[model samples]
Target: MNLNKYPVTELSGNGKLVYGCDYNPEQWSREVWQEDVQLMKQAGVNLVAINIFGWAELESSPGNYSFERLDEILDLLHEHGIGVNLGTGTSSTPAWLTTLHPEILPQSADGVRAWPGGRQAWCSSSPVYREHALRLVEQVSRRYGAHPAVRLWHVSNELGCHNALCYCDVSASAFRGWLRNRYETLDALNAAWGTTFWSQRYSGWDQVLPPRTTISAYNPTQVLDFHRFSSDELLGYYSAEAEILRQHSTVPVTTNFMITAHIRTQDYWSWAPHMDVIANDHYLDHRLEAPTIELAFAADATRGLAQGSPWLLMEHSTSAVNWQPRNIAKAPGEMIRNSLAHLARGADGLCFFQWRASVQGSEKFHSAMLPHAGTDSRVWKEVVELGGILERLTEVGGSTVTAEAALVFSWEAWWAYDRESHPSSDIAYLDQVHAAYKALWEAGITVDIVAPGADLSAYKLAVVPGLYLVRDSDAAALADYVAGGGHALVTFFSGIVDENEKVRTGGYPGAYRELLGIRTEEFLPLAPGDTPPLDNGTAASLWSEALRLEGAEAMVSFTGGHLAGTAAVTRNRHGAGTAWYLGTALEPAALRETLTQAAAGAGITVASTPEGLETVVRSNGDRSYVFLINHSHEEHKHAIQGQELVVGEEVADVVVVPAGAVRVVRTSTPAHPTNGLPTGSKDVESD
Candidate 1:
């Protein structure tokens, strides 16, 4: 977890926070560009991302390049003292190149070619696409690597957004090569993939294929490896382009990672070290029951990628997003609340997808800094107000977010646990993690979403929920953390499989059965819509395990479920700390209470504040910035003595925060207090 504290220092030039958006000069006329920059000055925007999807304009035809338009755009932006986060312009394939060579197109598992009408239509493993994309990348990096306006080199627009897995012949060959490197021989590969199960053993490496659309349910390990291969393939593409950019530039390189819930293509934990500055694109997912909770979880996970260092909020929306089934417009002042929430959780820079709304295209209806209604819009006013807020947060650029608890997050587990065959598909990895995180968030506990193998010594409490697939070493790390005076909460359906998705044969939850002092005989997965009652007056849900406690005490037991008297939750004393096991999914409210108790038992100071008023802190050496966001409709008052940065007022005691508003209190108090910490203080750093 060793990381540089804000490696991209240039982003905040002369101690000004970054407030900008993706600028598509290619989308507008020359006259409009001047107005846009002038408006940018008025809006306090200091940076703009350009050329993200500029492939068609950068290279109009094969062997014929034109940079005259881009040269003018960069010169104009620099004249206005606006820096650029330059993109390589290879995200979308040029129609000319794809038309000339259709082999570069990505194919579906059922042998369907995704055409060039959409962005990211190229296959990741195609040498032909790599040649053209790299050629374009080489040109862009060489031209702008030393350009004064270029502050960061964006490799591509969301590297694995669309073309993560292409089940084409080229992808098949690439997957075989990747497996060869991983397993080294056919025998090891067969053993790892467990090909002995369905008479699917492969004699030669040539027999291997991308787990293509199979008849029924495919081998789990094969699917898992292909998921690994697909992510690595896209990562390999990013690495190739980044290597070229590094040869030409000293500027920090990164791409906007899709850390939101919907996109799970790339494993960002593996991709984090490669980024000089961790940047993520997160949008409010309205489809969920609670998008706000998911937003907090996503930001925490992104910070974890940086190992709790400050990260960049690369992209978010100012209003309604066009992509969702129901594009819900943000209420007035809601945008401000969202941006402040990200800042409260470690984002140094706040940027959006585009500067202006599109007049035509698939994303025309998507929200932007300047929407279709132009300067008179509510979104435009909010964007200006947000820019002002960021300008006041100059001291928070490199300061880290505070966390006392840690949640183990894994992409491998996410890939494997959501496969076709599983007990209770209703219970998902995201659901369980979100449930735990929401609980912690409700308890006023800021948590770090860490990788399974990361050192957990810094946290007082560690939560491992629904991590179905974990490496043996990582499972041991959890046990070690618990044994070394760290409280652990391991939930149902976890520790059931190894890295290869192989079951631990002796009993369920093979990895941590000994440490938990429990042995499960069989799984008791409840049918959908069944919420059986627990003896503790709460309810057990989605899953349960028929188990016998060897050396643990039953904290809760089932009363109405199939296993009436079985232990639903157990607590065991390992060494210097305690290990808690949840055999069944508890109801959401009950889950929060249990998690809050675990947090309290670990000696974490659970806040007594009301649920809707979210409090988080960021600190430098001696100064602390307290951020308060009122999610509820009622106005709230907090006892804090400091100068409010947003409203530019001094508070003697109580700070009044209006409904649907955000407040940042600037004080000289140390955010991370070692001893005699005040009640309701969640400012202590995880380090």
Candidate 2:
């Protein structure tokens, strides 16, 4: 995708920051709809997403439809000058359809069909489900294809959210078909899956299944392939709907992506090309010890999924969410800080899950633009205030955030790394990535989460954390990137397996061994509570590799344990660039200090930031917009000089960023200049 052509300003026709929420007028009466829009306008909502869950209301029966309610809603929104992100209402199959064809319902891994009391009950691979879904999409697109108020076409609400993987017979048949196309022969499939291990070799394509519940653990390779198949199945459904929507409408089409790195079911790097606008639905993960750090990581990952083009914050919370074991409300100004955090990364649109709180649904407790307390609530006041803030910071739209460092995030690697029977089950792929990303985020350095195959030429440094499954092409690309003077940090457990989950021959980290200039004798995985001593009073846990340097210099080594005196970390000078290999997961403090030194070695500048303050700069050529966010309770003062765009104040030398507050400054300094870097380069550059 040519990112330059699809900048945020051009994607949003009016160049205004889109501020709105998922507006479900079907939940209310026509009399209440008027009041909803009046309140929406009062909150400065210019865009309203509608028809998300109206499939039952849209089609009461097969081949029978009703557009009366939808027509009234659209007319009201148009009259009020609010644009519409029209949804196809295909997320949930109607009760009538499911009642008639129960076969459309997705079957669980244990072979029980799902009941239809909730949404997304249909099987993605079922032809019957796709037939009806495409039909509904066509009808809705034809009805509002050229409507003046319709600005964007939302294909489906959170595709593959509930039924990402279905183990029904229909899905099994589809999985076999997908495998046939991929391997082309049963013999190749057996070879790739290493079926010879347990005398379990497939002779015919029909013998293949969807990795159902097994006696022992399912074959890791089979499970991995099934995961790929399931993801592609959902992507196929989305493409089918998008194709039909495109035939009837010329407006941009998108589907909200649940882009949390921990959710490894969907490969958004593959899905990004299909979307006209990359829209993500992010919820703060309260389960994490540091939810704010995870939020920033998700935002950066979402922006990178757009390939640095402008994307949308399609759904977030104004306050507490109904889900999660312990539903916690946002503290004062936390919501504003969260929204600004995404905006600082690269979101052009700020939207939420709902406009009004549901009065009688499972999500009744879910916060919205207008809470259950009505317009007099504190949540409502914050929503209105945020809307005003977005209006004033409209110029931040269409800007791009440049990063001197890039982190390679691979979904394929995540699947393989997180599989059972690993060296250590505690080594999570995203947790390691988040640890590295959080270190950089705290240093006030912007980092782009790019794919393995993405162009790395613009980045001075790249970090790959626990890339267990390394494709030959991807490895070659990274090798060339480092050879061209791009600095990289390759972590433990990387380069161990191939795309087929087969261990590479010769040595560990097979493809990168030469470029990284290190040979691993064996993996010394630590137990759950074990911590091995390392240099500089830092410890290593979870994973450790016994490394032997070939042409690399040991940067850090083990001081205790069986692998004492072995290299824990090494740096290799390869061609014009440098490659740093971390053989073990270091302690947090050590990891931070090591990364700081590595980044400086790569000529990447890290801002001197306070402990809880985050600084991000989004640039458009020569002009830069700096976002200073204080995430701590203590106040922070940064020496900054620019025009404060949020409150329209002129900032001289020092600016005080209050606790839980954000300040956006427009300055004339260029964030990053080419400086002899090749144009349209795909890999990293060196000094």
Candidate 3:
């Protein structure tokens, strides 16, 4: 039987809880430090992310370093019995370096040189920047690598922040290198980029430059190349620091990834294999649908990276987050509910953004373990209660579970879409992907968020929507998956470009033309609310492409705006399996039907649950735990089965705890197996 090292575990259906919070003693006095630890212990907080923004304090000058304060803080935390995810403190460059070598500073896309006021403001392509940053990380890793309390190595904090697309001399040089590696000859490069039409063909390697205003010409090909180059450049920074940490540390290495921002830079699929446990900082606007469903996608993305290994919920808000438009306090039980949501989604550890309230600066108003109102506040009580629950469920502490189906998501595709310069600028790639994910969630199917090249044998089907970029071997892999009896579902704007961000010339959906069995000859951009009548007599808009089936059968056809009776959806059968293609961005109703039909062809089963009930199942060996979270404001009844594990009585019209309340129901008999994960499923409840 296949076994997992850390399987999902549940304490009688109340999910497993891992407690930790971001601890920044640098912002607080020593007197306050003592109180923070005491409160953390009371909350059952066990993991601490320390020294996230300490490079300025650690290395004050060239060849001079100070660790007296950090040493004391580490010792104090160790004495308090908390595990540490140690930060290398190289995220923010020292002011001295930026002052001496101004080239180390990043330039914006509009070619404006960035002022080094915020963290992660250094240029990725700057040699001086990389050299010093590497030195600092090496020094920090060497000194703290042996700490007994250190559980994981946290690389430079959230490496991708705002204004990530830098276009400087260093970036220009790197872009040329990237192009040379991707396309060996100028002729090949020109042909792939279709530069002959615009007189953009390069005569020599020296003529190549980063896609900037001066030499870029601002064409679709140029913008796409620039996006690819910037992504690789940022990845290089991550690679350098990861290598440094690996040299001195045996623990897994990770950098904090944030939710809903900087979607282009940090490609976790590329970096996940290097991480011991992927950690994320989740702070969403409360007005948005409770982020529990989004959190499940994040967890699956993390698990997919480590092949079903659980990750850490590194930084969540204990109370309120300061970054939102309106910094609203998490309502009664919302904090605890959100934490449980993370666990329900497969988090092995739960940590907040701050342990204590920041006394000053940008995050001063942000909530923490101890709110500004002090220890006796409601927030503090909730934190303590949450900790007590975690303390009680120590048995399922380091568990993980497996996913049977996954949706393929890629950052390269995201970046490429941003640079595509399509006829419609309003077509949002992230929103499209989330729409697909939301449909799958609404259908009660357990969907694992995956990156390109993730193993498809374990999953019966894989769905990739809005895949604008296809690199080397990616097409081959998808073809292989289909040829091997695994079904694939892909949507609009796919197979248009190669790894070089150049359009594939033979036909539209170029590389995947044969696999998809369709040739997109005409680009038909439909305006919003404009109806493109389909063969089924149904109309749709939001961008439509007139496509003809080459060896495939049309499922839906456009019938308006000069493309009537043109194929909008088609399917190709290949080696006992099928490839479904969506040519137009359908509305939610049609998209769900299309997704459901595609899934049925693959034999993927949807859970028997009510609509809007966010469901996720993580299995180990013979047991599986399904989390049914009713995220909507109104109460609803959810019909759930698959070996009930929760201890409480099963109610038919189960009152799925409203907006902030959660229920933990057992779904299976816990039978520990040899060589399997410690717990099959644990700590599953809605926040």
Q: Which ten residues in a row have the lowest lDDT in candidate 1?
A: 678-687
Task: Write the residue-wise lDDT of candidate 1 on 32-143 in tens digits.
Answer: 9999999999998887889999999989898788999999999999999889999999999999998999999999989999888989999999999999999999999988
What would you estimate as the lDDT of candidate 1?
Answer: 0.86
Candidate 2: clashing residue pairs, number: 7
Candidate 3 lDDT tens digits, 82-179: 77778888888878888888887878666888888777778788888888888989888898888877766788777666646778878888888988
Candidate 3 has what TM-score? 0.86
Winner on TM-score between 1 and 3 is 1
Model 1 collision count: 0
Instruction: State model 2's lDDT.
Output: 0.84
lDDT of 3 at 498: 76
lDDT of 1 at 313: 86
Query: Which ranking of candidates, highest lDDT first?
Result: 1, 2, 3
Check candidate 2 and list the clashing pairs: 455-682, 456-682, 456-683, 456-684, 457-682, 457-683, 457-684
TM-score for candidate 1, please give it: 0.97
Per-candidate total of colliding backbone pairs = 0, 7, 31
Q: What lDDT tens digits, residue by residue, belong to model 2 across residues 1-687?
A: 232344444433467888889998888888999898888889988888899988999999998999998998999999998889899999998889999999999998899899999989999999998888888888998888999888888888888889898999999999999999999989999999999987889888888998888787778999999989988988988889888878887778888999774467898888888888888999997988788888888888989988787788989999999978999999989999999999988999899989989999899999898988988878888898998999899988888887788999988888878878877778899888888888777766688999986789988889998888888899989889989998999888888888999898887778799989999878888888788888778888888877889999999888987889999999999999999998888878788888888888889765556787877778877778878788889887766567887777897665677778988887777664331111221111111
